[model samples]
Target: MSPTIEAISAMPNGEKPTYLLVMLHGWGANYQDFVPFAKMLNFPGFGYFFPNAPFEHFQVPGGRAWYALEENEFTGLATSRKLLLNWLTSLEASTGVPLDRTVMAGFSQGGAMTLDVGLTLPLAAICSFSGYLHYQPEFQDNKTFPPTMIIHGQQDPVVPIEAAKKAQDELTKIGVSVQYQEFMMGHEVQDPAIALFKQFIQDNLNFN
Candidate 1:
C-alpha cells in the first residue's frame, strides 16, 4: 500500500468540487503554512489540500520538512518524493477530482518537490512560487508535462532568483509551456505573485 501523508483540506461551501489545488509548504513549515491561501485565493468549486511533509524537522521545533537538508546534501529527497508522488497519485480516488482537473503548487523547498514529482504526473497545471528545480528531469516522449508558472523574487535570498531563471531554461528545453515572472521582493510570496497565481490558476483549471 502507498503511504498517505496527513493533510489539511479546505473547500468552499457548496456541492462537489470540479477542480483541486494541492499546495506544498516550504521547509521548516507545516501543512498549515499555506492553508490561508485557500481563503486568500478563494475560487468557487475548487477544493484545496495541504499535505504535511512526511518527517518532523530535526532542528526547528513544531516544524515539518519534506526532506532533510544536512551537511550541504539532500538527505531524504528520494523518500519524500516517493511519498508525495504516492499521495498525489491517490488524490483522484479520495477527492473525486481527477489529475487532469488538479493543479499542484509549492514554495521554496516545497517548490522544488513540485517540479520534481509534479512533472511526472498528469496534472492540469503547476505553479512554482519562489521555487527551484532539484535536477533536470530526463526527457521522456511518453510524458506530457502540464503548463507551468515559475515565479520568483528578484531579491530572494533563501533560494536565489537565478534558481527560477535556471528552472525556466531547463523546463523550456523539455518542451514545457512556461510562464515566468520576477518580483522586486525576497524569499516570500507577495501581492504581485498572488495576483499572478490567481490569474494562472484561473486560466488552467476547470471550474463549475
Candidate 2:
C-alpha cells in the first residue's frame, strides 16, 4: 500500500475542474505554502492539487520533504518517486482526471521531484523550476515524453544553474521538446519566470 499523503486543492471559479495541475512544494515546506502560488498561476478551468510530501516533521515545524537528502540520494529519489506514483495513481482513480491531462510542476527539491517523477509519467506537461536531472538507464528509452520547461535562476546557490541546464540538454537529446530560461536572480521564483510559466501552460495545456 502507498503511504498516506495530504494535499490542498483549488478549482477555478469554485466549479468542477477539467484539468489537473499538481504542484509540489520545496523541501522544509508544507502543502499550504503553495496555496497563494496556485492562485498566481491563474490557469482557467484547471484544478490545482498541492500535495504535501509524506516526509513531514522536518526543518521547520510542519515542514515536509519528498525524501531525505542527507541519506543515500539515489535511494531517496527512488523511494519518493514510488510514493509520488502511487499518489498520482490514486488521484486519477478518485478524480477521473487522466494522467495525460495533468501538469506536474515544483520548486527546489519539489522541482527535482517534478523532473524525476514527471519524466517517467505520461503527463501533459512538466515544469521544473530550479530542478536537476538524475540520469537513469530506463529514462534513455522513454519515447512518449511530454513537452517540458526548465526555469532556473543564474545565481541559485542550492541547485546550480548547470544542473538545470543538464536537465534541459538531456531532455532535448531524447527528442523531448524542452524550453529553458534563466533569470538574473537567485533560488526563488520571480515575475519573469511566472509570466513565461503562464505562457507555457497556455500554449501547451489544451483542455479540449
TM-score top scorer = 1
Segments in model 1 whose C-alpha atoms lie over 4 Å from true places: 1-4, 206-208
Query: How does each model score on TM-score?
Result: 0.94, 0.90
Global lDDT for candidate 1? 0.87
What is the per-residue lDDT of model 2 for residues 1-208, given as tens digits with 9 covering 90 to 100?
A: 5545788888777876667889999888888877886679777778899998877544678888788765665445666778788888777776778888888899988888887778778898999988776554244653778788999999999899999888887777777788899999798999999899888887887532
Model 2 deviation from the true structure expressed as Cα RMSD, one decimal place: 2.3
Among all windows of 10 consecutive residues in model 1, the one with the lowest summed lDDT is 199-208
Q: Look at candidate 1 and tell me the lDDT of residue 96.
A: 94
**lDDT per prediction?**
0.87, 0.81
